[model samples]
Target: MTATDDKTVVREYFNATGFDRWQRIYGDGEVNKVQLDIRKGHQQTVDTLMGWLEADGNLAGLSCCDAGCGVGSLTIPLAQAGAQVYASDISAKMVEEARQRAEVALEGKNLPTFEVKDLEELAGRYHTVICLDVLIHYPQDKVQGMISHLGSLAESRLIMSFAPKTLFYSALKKVGEFFPGPSKTTRAYLHREADIVKALEAEGWRIERRTLTKTQFYFSRMLEAVKDQ
Candidate 1:
């Protein structure tokens, strides 16, 4: 399929029931069960990301974008930390749920604006732009274009996460495909670290740090990169 076609399928799939079901499941305190063995290091991952943001110190008054900001998991925290965040998702239901969660999570505090949008429609540059766990929806060949678009949307830094590629990881992904309870979308792509780095390099992005979170179901790798001006 062409990149446009793949994006359309991804957009449709996320809008259907996948995103809402995931939000319902994870938002209801089932993250531990759904994630199984990886629960122990969840806070560490968040802490590490927060540490990265804090290191720059420029995050205090920066405008940020959380692309594919599912259920406000990362969006709420960024807003609470004082970033002017704009969060968006392909799923309208997911956006609504995220808005509700932000209302409760932020309470009287300033919260990020949430909207229904896909990565392709995202515009403008941000001090920091985050797209986590969203790359799986794109095919491998199109990841470079997507990464380029994401990199262009960031003025200084771009943070992203993807399912790591390895022989064992591929096996696990295949297993998930077979035993899926919900997410049954075809053509989800798992990415290799080297390939991802190459994609970033093509768009003049320099990787500053990367974190690998290992789990039974999947392995997630988070990266922080700076655009070469």
Candidate 2:
């Protein structure tokens, strides 16, 4: 698809009425279990990243950028940990909710800088750059370029997640496609581990750790890598 087509699809999905429904689902406390599971999954990935950061003693005063930061899930925690954070999302509503959530979670602490912008508009280098559940919206042909761009925004580390590629996983994804619900982006692209590695390697990033999680709705693979400096 052309760039315009890509943007249109993204805009439609994020701006659609379905997203409003999703925001309510995500923001409601009635579904605490679902939220907890989601948090647990993200925390697992964050723990792995923290371990990597600790390996190098000179990593303090680090700045982190959370591209596609939704509802401040990882963003607020990172900010609470005293890291300078810059978070951005393509959806205006998502950014607004994230800002509100951050205000409450970071009431007595410094807040991360939040904005509504696409990954391509991101500027400045951070010690760590995270793009989670964001790349799935991009077409297969554009993933490598997107990865390279994210890598450039990081001075030391980059962590990203993608839907895994497997027969079982693909079948499950197809089922999800059938039961369409409100999400910022509707189109999902599953990536093979080998292909994901190749894309990062092409941008001179070396994978340091990988983790896979299988949930009822999705199978996610997260990777932590270091940019070749």
Can you give the lDDT of residue 194 in candidate 1? 95
Give per-residue CA lDDT, model 1, range 6-113, as digits (tens). 767766766776665566544546554544334334445556787888787876778999999877777888888888999999888788888998889889588888
**Top-scoring candidate (TM-score):** 1
Model 1 bad stretches (over 4 Å):
1-5, 30-32, 35-44, 177-183
Off by over 4 Å in 2: 1-3, 16-18, 32-60, 177-185
The numbered model that scores best in lDDT is 1
lDDT (CA) per prediction: 0.78, 0.75
Clashing pairs in 1: none
lDDT of 1 at 106: 86
Q: Between which residue pairs do clashes occur in model 2?
A: none
The sequence of per-residue lDDT tens digits that candidate 2 reaches over residues 1-229 is 6765776677566656645654555554554444445545555665666665556654445798999887777787677777888999887878888899999988957789998898888889888999987777777788888898988888888899887778877786677642244443456778888988999988888998888865445457889998655
lDDT of 1: 0.78
